[model samples]
Target: MPLYKTITPNSQTTVKIWKITESYQDLMAKVNLKPVALERVLGMKSELHQRGFLSVRHLLQEFGYTDSDLFYDENGKPHLKDGKHISITHSFNFSAVIVSDLIVGIDIEKQRDKIAVIANKFIDYEFDYLNKMEGDYVKKLTVIWCVKESLYKLFATPGLSFKQHCLVIPFTLLDAETVAWIDYEDKKHRYNIHFFEFEGFTCAYALV
Candidate 1:
């Protein structure tokens, strides 16, 4: 499949998503990968994961970049050669990348009832606005989880606890946007959060 969606959140930021319907061999033949990336993809045991990786490279190609333009730091966070901030995520059948002049992070998660089981592990302040009795409880929980995960990716700090260090302001599904803060160490940071759901998956992105 080609590009699934594209969003220009700001003048200097672009988010692109790809729906992975191509076979591993097909995707491999289409995208140009660096030697390290080639070896990494071949080492993946699951074809689904390999396909997702390749789809991300395809998304990079859409932005006129190849695998050589990207690299990972010691913390496993990705970076671009040209110094723009980039965040990548893939879940099941979808892969996405967000590139921005400002610091940014993105996450995509499959909405499942099981998330409610582990909600307490990463949720705290946001529970005040969440009512489990509502029918959209699971969906709301998924959004909160993605929001925290997005903030985590942006911070990329060691020993940061999602439940303790991150706080997502109250938000409703209809609003589609909110604010979040990271109170880590002796400093505090803020972010603008945006989210949406499609095909049983929820995507949340934070711009700082």
Candidate 2:
């Protein structure tokens, strides 16, 4: 099933990650997609994306759910039929989902050098503490990006700017945990951030 790793951040939340080592046919046969989902997969131009989409359904099955039990809101956020919160993310050769009684968000991103080139656009308060001259700069940048993205998905709020609205506290790679806050609409929200790395990719999850 290629269920690479599973983590229970709390009693109510479960995180499942899939390492895409199966053929498209292999994955497609493992899960049944609804008519709309079938059409969506058929419309994808890249086989990698199709596999990622199908792999998510497999994860759902692991949690005793199915494609029919999921739906998306007008904001494009995914929701569970039973009213639990759900967030999904897929990157090259990997996919992940998190289901929790509390609001949650998950993001998986491949480590790349390009993140350094555009770090200014999304980084504000963090720049002061980041040691750009260090060897782990790219890793730090990627973690910050993932943290902000997870928060974005959790909030699902429109017109939110990563640079202006979200802030991640500074921490070393060894910390594996940190804090983040979103200031918008005259409100302040905080989240507990936990992260880990595997095979040159970083995945971070946030919970309120």
Candidate 3:
């Protein structure tokens, strides 16, 4: 089991990351999936996605849960049957899960220059502080993207627009933490965002 790292952001919240170095068959043999999950995995056209899906089940096991203990809401957010909050993400070769007594979200994304091309789609006020000429521009963009993605997962609202509603406070790469807001429907919500990079990928999580 390549359980790469574990983080306890608070007494009630835990984050686990998995570095996927297993074959799809190997990962499949290690996890027992519910019928629906099994069918879903079998239907994935990309083997990488199948392995990512299976690796998440392995992370759930690390948190003392199983495939049967997880379900999705109408908005596609994951929930725990035991009433604990849960969020999951997987990118290329990495997968992660965050479980907390408080509402929480997590995301892992491969840092790529291509993300800058679509920055305008999900970025708004953040552009004021982002300097495209900066050496860490791509890294910073990846962090912001991860942070908003986490917020989206936690909010799970259908109309929340990342560009128009979600805003990440400015911070340097060294900060490793920042604040983000969801300004929507005449109300504002705040969340603490923490992020880190490993093996050319970024992982971030949000909590109230």
lDDT of each: 0.93, 0.95, 0.95
Candidate 2 on 70-106: residue-level lDDT in tens? Answer: 9999898999999999999999899999999999999
How would you encode candidate 1's per-residue C-alpha lDDT over 100-170 as one tens digit per residue?
Answer: 99999999999999999999999998889999999899999998888888888888888999999999999
| Clash pairs (backbone) in predicted model 2 | none
lDDT of 3 by residue, 142-200 (tens): 99999999999999999999999999999998899999999999999999999999899
Once model 1 is optimally superposed onto the true structure by TM-score, how far is the C-alpha of residue 102 displaced, in angstroms?
0.5
Model 2 lDDT on a 0 to 1 scale: 0.95
Consecutive 10-residue window with the lowest summed lDDT within model 3: 1-10
Off by over 4 Å in 3: none
Question: Which residue pairs show collisions in model 3?
Answer: none
Q: Which consecutive 10 residues in model 1 have the weakest lDDT in total?
A: 149-158
How do the candidates rank by lDDT, highest first?
3, 2, 1
